[model samples]
Target: MAAGAPRVFVSHLSGVAVFDPNGDQVGRVRDLVAMLRVGQRPPRLLGLVVELSTRRRIFLPMTRVTGIESGQVITTGVLNVRRFEQRPTERLVFGELLDRRVTLTETGEEVSVLDLSVQHLPARRDWEIDRVFVRKGRTGSAFRRAKGETLTVEWSAVTGFSLEEQGQGAESLLATFEQLRPADLANVLHHLSPKRRAEVAAALDDDRLADVLEELPEDDQIEILGKLKEERAADVLEAMDPDDAADLLSELPEDDKERLLNLMQPSEAADVRRLMSYEEHTAGGLMTTEPIILRPDATVADALARVRSADLSPALAAQVYVCRPPDDTPTGKYLGTVHFQRLLRDPPYTLVSAIIDDDLQPLDPNATLQLIAGFFATYDMVAAPVVDETGSLLGAVTVDDVLDHMLPEDWRETEFHLDESDEADEDNEEVAAHDS
Candidate 1:
């Protein structure tokens, strides 16, 4: 089913007869399983908790379901007879999500989650609960059907939350600040009550949480990381920049740090482990393993293309490290740096090797924080390459990391305020001036 296809509300699927590709009745969809994601992104529809003829329930993954039309689910005849065991990440839609009281972002009026509409994402087997069918009245058991002020809105429109008090959801709180920068979001997380903070953090996707984790104070990082399931914690750490991930891990007890590292993908774990081996304030410790690395033969255009990635921080993108054969850090013999400006000035076909700034001295991995800061200050450079004794590029240290280390510990503790009134006033004044 396409994303644009009509969404089937979970209420309509209660006990919906599921059939095989040959049109034989397999079972009925007792409940839909969904895995909630971080932030306001929709929860993924994992599969159906189908009760077979033998009265044994099994999980039929969305991948196995080819179609859900005419009130019948068509499966690929590949059903896992194993009992449906809900993982820590899975939520049974009928059991947990429905009939919850949530609020509208616009009016802040509470509504009952009568049903959730799941949609098949375009060109993929994945499905997600994209809309919430709610009624502006009292709440009760899940899947309660009633008529009064009924309307279906995007999932975001509901007062999303899983609160210890009342029924406000974490997604509701996060939706209010969805556009915040990671640092700003970290500030919001920092000031929240511990329980609320963890809930909010848990709702964020791994990559986003990783970005926020990097900005948070060490204490906050530890607290939040501890609250997450180990598997998820490892995943979040893997998503973070290697240097940042290492720093967070180092704050944990040795046992915990090692456990998470082992759970991470081997390559990602290796990078974090290598970074942790360095002195906390040294170039090796501060340099990110995933810098823009290009070979000597790579064209200026190639270097430019790598630099333009939205994933890279501005400081990291400010230059490309030209190394020899092994492109992965610690890359083969370090050649020299090619600044972004240089890439722009040269023709696209020009070799990055021909315009190398070899005269610039690269920092040793063991270079001190003060030394790294001095190097950046002296050259007016946003980033610098870190080379080892073997003339290999260990990684590149961006100025942001240098400043992060050099700044006072309390710098990140400053309270964040989103005051747009001044900007609004300025805009009004400018408008008035223009009108006059």
Candidate 2:
């Protein structure tokens, strides 16, 4: 069937029906699902789930579904009913793949399949298999196997199907923000409009929201924060990196900022405030308060213990910073950073400094956005330390923050620009003076 063929409605179909490709009766369609809002048209058919024997179900993709005849449905592919009916260790074959990694040939990158697309096939009176699309990242660009791309065989691939389990998992979506590559997340966010960005953020839980927020640009952070309810906004901010939280707060109106800060827990609010106290363009302002700081004398085992207790960001670098006692020059007199990957192979009792990288590329407090962008491009650094003139650590600026300043014109609204033009016209008195 042509891709753009006009859609047809199935007649005499009171509800959904399910059948195998070989024309075996499976189950009946329960409902047609869609996203409908006020002023929006009724939800279109996306896909259907057939309730087979013993509560087993299969998703029929909308693309492969043709048309429905009287009491019969047509499908594009042939499926064995027994393969879908066998029970695997996991209750549902589809559910077992949730959160599992899959690679897409189009991008030659791996992504987690977030959600499966299902649609009703009226011709077969059954659901048909659709292309399996993977969630690319939080920004919502999905990775689909291009036409004719061979599916690579892996232990994770579904070979023989089973039907023992017949229900959905707690969270049926496969891919999540934490599982996405930072670069992919950035790409996705850059492409999303403010409204779409809000919808995506609203769909995520707090933790997932925090993960994506940390990877997004500052303007995006501000835009998304503006759209969320005060409580949800506060929750997401509280869960974000301290430096990121501070940057976002700085961009918000004073009243909104204060309100959100007040809504946060005492500890989280304090951390944000401390970060905010620094100048906006300074290193102190950019450094995250959540860094894994440890004593120079601490052993690998001790550092590992601290890591376990701390709520480390998922995108943490391979290194951990070694610090002196809490003092005015705590970060200025930094010992070094221990490479985390090395620690895994080294003795547990090894001193942290023994594995530290003293030549870390640190940021200066007065650095400009352009300069930061240069650093990000040159060093390919995910995170960099920011320090004051006194050599004291202020905060850290990350690649995501730098990218925020480089956003394309479409990312922000033009209302302010239009207002400026209006003001300039009003200020020009020559035309008015001539008229007078």
Candidate 3:
């Protein structure tokens, strides 16, 4: 783990209240889900099993989580309220891991699992088990173990928790392709048999699956999505970019589309619903609702901070949209845009409004695909804000999205190429590891 990566002991998170961005309490963290890897590899943190105020237990994908501060957990407010069902590959940290017996590799001493620590992998949203807190004494109640030694050690120092050495399946396949980019993984999935594609899709964490889905062909997207449980399908959609999710939903049968939409959190569904209200090729339909938004009074430093978010795509981070109030889309009257270059040129304390590029006219929500393409070409802009007739900032359409529409519908399938030798080398290594 990196020195400064966010690390949290599972004990501290027990029963912590989870709140939405609006400060509304949603639930409490009941347990965490993790996937065990083969051999001694640290398990991957999957998501949280939260108990909502309504006494409903739902799974909260860590991708939707924004912060884990003192005594509380913060979310992006886009939760899927479906009951959490454990898969054959998933283990609950609180229920299945704690109080278990594990052995210290160095001295071969058996100990009781007290807690496990998870840390975010550097520069990525993925997290993993990196350390274990154990008690070096006879396993029993807390009082019984009072005199025993307790210490935290690296995950590799402990035995147990990982999958069997002979383990082979979708997760192992996923391990072989762990370093593959989302686009590459999507291509792999695209070429796989339907059963294999669905198997690997089921093994992927929600955020990862969402990213791959965005890169996949529409047919593959629908096939993989149809194979997922309806509740899980809704959760995956919620994790996807709003515009992309909306596009996928539009392609589904009307009954299926409405059902999944209804299954989603209201806040997330509303964004998709709003986008679906527009023509397929229009600016309103193509724009992502989660662009970096700021108020006119926000300083250049603040804009830079938003731009620096690792979650943003390059085009979305190319500029910050300035609005009046209400920082989220359909934000208050559109003020202007502060391109990244302008923010870099100004002092940190300079207000964004003073550096706004209001001279360039914004795109209309109903702008045609040809018009949108022309605007991008004419201004040499990678992204352009879309404003409604009421002057509220709806969202910003990026150049990539415009190109996606203008390209042949089969472009994603046509351009993807998988290196056969790379797969063979990885497969050979996989066989060698399991054979030994």
Candidate 4:
């Protein structure tokens, strides 16, 4: 540790927004870069690996950093703007140091590194590890009743162990990512090499992995899905939003797609199948089959309960569909929807049908993308129900899905966006979360 040098924990640096001199966010710090040194010297801070709005990873040298405060990293406005590529001698602090196993000098008790604090060198253009935050616990200790206490010690007091020989390569990295939001985790996964991405993906649970997969680009989606065993891949797909699952399946070979779908639970598979049957540009294809649905007789309390379920997506939870019988698809008959706001304004025991939005016309499953777009614009709705020819409720097409479909292909891979609709959808999710 150097006197008069600014310090920040590596964990705090992860996902911190990087702003230019004008206070405009240029990107987010995905990882910190450092060059491993000889002897007992700590690795020298090289720069930061930042991911831009376009999802490109670029390097920003530490020398360019002018300030670090208030959850943001300020830069000198001067940037390389070049893609980041790890050199042979460099190591990522978050990717390699955090969650790694190390031995405490005093007790000789092994601990897993939880975080690292780095300090800028005084009167120099460099930074070095100052402290190591380590947790005293064995593998899978998180599930145990008694948790380990984390300790912060000088970096020299701990010795790093090799994860590869411990039969847990990248497991530590994946564990750290478990705390990040799905979108942030997806960004981290996207920056990794193909092999590393697959390893981390394999380590995540089906639901978490599915969330990250939905955030990833279509090509990356297929690549990671292909790496999983058929059964696990099916589970991940089943956990994803039906529309997203269908879109991914649509990109796969027919035989492979069918095989994965068959491995899913029949109810889930049926929903995905119905979605896949629709043309890519149709409302059905853009809809999610898992919206909150209830019988017309269901109470406002019931609707509220459904909306509050953690499993439902924000768009799906925004409204409740009131149908006839057979609550699942075909949903018996297309009745009407009751917005969450309506539920909140009514008495708890009141029937949902009593306050349903009868004037809200449902989109036909065969409705074209343009027609669906017009329907959203006309109704000013965040989501709308899709019905079959017999007036059976199929699913609900969300505004976000429609926006994604309208974007040009390869939008995720390109720097120039067709529009900021995706970003707007992200904002909508945040607002919905707060409202809920």
Q: Of the candidates shown, which would achieve the greatest TM-score relative to the real structure?
A: 4
Q: Where does the lowest 10-residue lDDT sum fall in candidate 4?
A: 427-436
Better of 2 and 4 by TM-score: 4
1 versus 2: better lDDT goes to: 1
Instruction: Report the lDDT of model 4 for residue 375.
Output: 83
For model 1, the superposed segments whose C-alpha errors exceed 4 Å read 1-168, 415-436
Q: Candidate 3, which segments miss by more than 4 Å at Cα?
A: 1-168, 416-436
Q: Report lDDT per candidate.
A: 0.79, 0.53, 0.81, 0.79
Better by lDDT, candidate 3 or 1: 3
Instruction: Write the residue-wise lDDT of candidate 1 on 112-170 in tens digits.
Output: 66668888888776788899978786643222234469898997776564433444335
Best-to-worst lDDT order: 3, 1, 4, 2
What residue pairs are clashing in model 1? 38-203, 38-204, 38-205, 39-203, 103-159, 160-169, 161-168, 161-169, 161-170, 162-169
For candidate 1, the TM-score is 0.61
Evaluate model 4: give its TM-score.
0.80
**Models, CA RMSD each:** 19.2, 19.3, 16.7, 7.7
Q: Per-residue CA lDDT of candidate 2, range 243-342, in tens? A: 7788778888899989999999988998899878867655566566666677778899987776665455433544567777662333546666666677
Worst 10 residues of 1 by lDDT: 427-436
